[model samples]
Target: MTRSPGAGLHLHLDPLGGAAGDMFVAAMLDAFPELEPRVMADVIAILPPEAGQAELSRGQSGGLAVRRFALLPNRRGEEAKPRGHQHEHDHGHGHGHHHHATTYHALRTRIETAPLSQGTAAAAAAILHHIALAEAHVHDMPLDEVHFHELADWDALMDVTAAGSICAALEGATWSLTPLPLGGGLVRTAHGALPVPTPATARILQGYEWHDDGIGGERVTPTGAAILAHVTGGTAGTRRGGRLRAVGMGAGTRDLDDRPNILRVTAFAASSGAGADRIVQLACDLDDMTGEEIAAAADALRAHPGVADLVLVSLLGKKGRPATRMELMVYPAAEAAVAAAIFDLTSSLGLRRTELDRLILPRSATISVEGIRVKRADRPSGATAKAESDDLVHAPTLRARRQLAHRTETG
Candidate 1:
């Protein structure tokens, strides 16, 4: 296994209730509790010029007090806070740089110019890309025209950028999450009223486990989904006898009589033994399926959060019957849901599955080259950087920047 200073730190996310951006950052703070000042400082230093000042608060969620941050934007000389995912995000902010709806490219440019760590920038860009791609599909518009909408606010940006910095602050610590709960019911948005787990949220969280908790209003926000996508390394399943370090509980503003309506996270000491990391691979054969059905099946497979890779092959089966084989490489926690999807969507009754071990480097870093943010993975051999496709479009000279990225990747 690749070693590092924070090698033994592991996090278990119990998002069974629901998830949100503020909830995640708050829960993490609940773990460190004392790191609130430092994390907020880093976030403030990088707050966008168009955004306003942020104020933090300590409050109770289900009787457990937590640290939460709120953005105070000067709207007509009147400060405003988010109201249950309700914000007046018009194309015209009537002040500063937000004169019109910020397009994907423009925001990409803004992120490129911001003074932030490479990993922080790249993580933010990647999360935005996830939302952009999904929004493009949901709105059936060109990716370039798809503006940030409700996602363009200062709070949303802070939510994403803050998440990036916090993950980096953890050093080599690894992040894993449990199945997510899709809060059921209707919710308002920039694009009119939509279902809970909004189209973009559903799109970004295609492959994760979700269920209705019978709560009205949105439980999971796009920022929350983006945070999970930005930091989480899919499903890490259950930790076997790892030491519990800290438990953080973040409560949502809405009070539900049935439950506490909180998001709790458990911090654990990373396993120091063999078989610490393993993934599940499932394979099934398909013969009696239509082309349209096959296409939809492939889309469903690709959207799942736990799947690492998926492959489809055509071949001749018994009695020379033409058939196709579906091979899926998914995280161990996704086996059941993936199998259920396969059976429900295709003509498959049984599946072949196997678990394999993997060694992961403890460190996560980012490097910016020519104003382009790239996610860096450190290996013993060296480091490799990956630019988010959504924001990489801003890079004018990819060839030269790629070389610079490589050279700068060296610590």
Candidate 2:
């Protein structure tokens, strides 16, 4: 059977040693080797012929086989040198640039204008933007003034872009991550010896959960942090339930005696029927607020990134007061934030909260048709498509809007 695009896909990251850009790409490619050629081609297409080359090699970590990705940058007429994950300068600011440094703006422009798929370019640009934000925060400088130091070479670019390509390939996949291991130690950089998880890396992973494992080294590099930040959206948490589909191990440069330096990535598939999951539901009734105030509150709740879905309904309250009852559904991880948002946005003094089991049917992602994005779902009857009503906000007439939606869904 031909699988629909983005159907029932889930990805979980287990950063055993730590995460780096190279390891992220390698692990993803290892799991989906079929994507390797296309990823490499995209990377090469964006980069100049003389810039360098990217390759994947088989290696072993603790006697277990793994795949490693490296960027070999061409130096003059000499053969390209492979800058592996062990090189601190790959993400550190300590090294003096042997070549002209590229600004964050330039890098973003390069990636954005590169000959790559729309999804890959957008993903790669977002990842670079995350890194730029971290760097700007660390240096206390304007984003434009921040020049590429550690990532000046093609090494960081390849790692990040490859990671972006992998993410693009896995679009519609639910991404989750394990708590990262906080390795303790001093790392040498342009600013001299600094604590492990370098300044930029720390900033990039500000909200992420980390636990010290007594393993001392650069666990998560800045590039890795940016990639994770992009994936988790700063809401790093444990994996959800799903059926395992594939697994891949990506090895780093250094192999420790106590543990292997490898990252494990696992892909999962949503089951054939509705999947059972737990979610939090909060409800509140308000009779004292004006319609405008209630509408504003509901809008705020709906706009919150943590909120899954929200509904408002008319109801009769005490004294036969006309009131609006607001109900919000959110995942357990986001319940606290959503609850706080409710209190901040509404005039309600109290809320009714409940943990509910919800069954979700597997659905495909929204795809653009005739420049209109349409969502699709699989049903026993067949497949169905629904055009987003928001896309018709500018329509001249209701009949025209209906006609456009019908064409988008049917075509």
RMSD, one per candidate, in order? 6.0, 6.1
How do the residues 1-411 of candidate 1 rate in per-residue lDDT, one tens digit apiece? 234434456676776446776677777888876767766765675564445676666786555566565577766653333333342211111122333356888766665567775355665666667667777999999988887765555666676666766665664555666666666666655566677678887877765667665655677777677667655543333443368989987655666666666677888775553325677888887888887888899888877766767999998988899888888887766678778887887888899988877665443333332334444454555434465454455547988556555544442
Global Cα lDDT for candidate 2: 0.74
Worst 10 residues of 2 by lDDT: 81-90
- Candidate-wise lDDT, in order: 0.63, 0.74
The 10-residue segment of model 1 with minimum total lDDT is 87-96
* Residue ranges of candidate 2 with Cα displaced over 4 Å: 1-4, 73-100, 272-274, 280-354, 360-411
Q: Highest lDDT: which candidate?
A: 2
Pairs clashing within candidate 1: 8-270, 119-366, 207-304, 207-305
Question: What's the TM-score of every candidate structure?
Answer: 0.71, 0.71
How would you encode candidate 2's per-residue C-alpha lDDT over 263-291 as one tens digit per residue? 89888887765667788899999998899
Model 1: per-residue Cα lDDT at residue 200 = 82
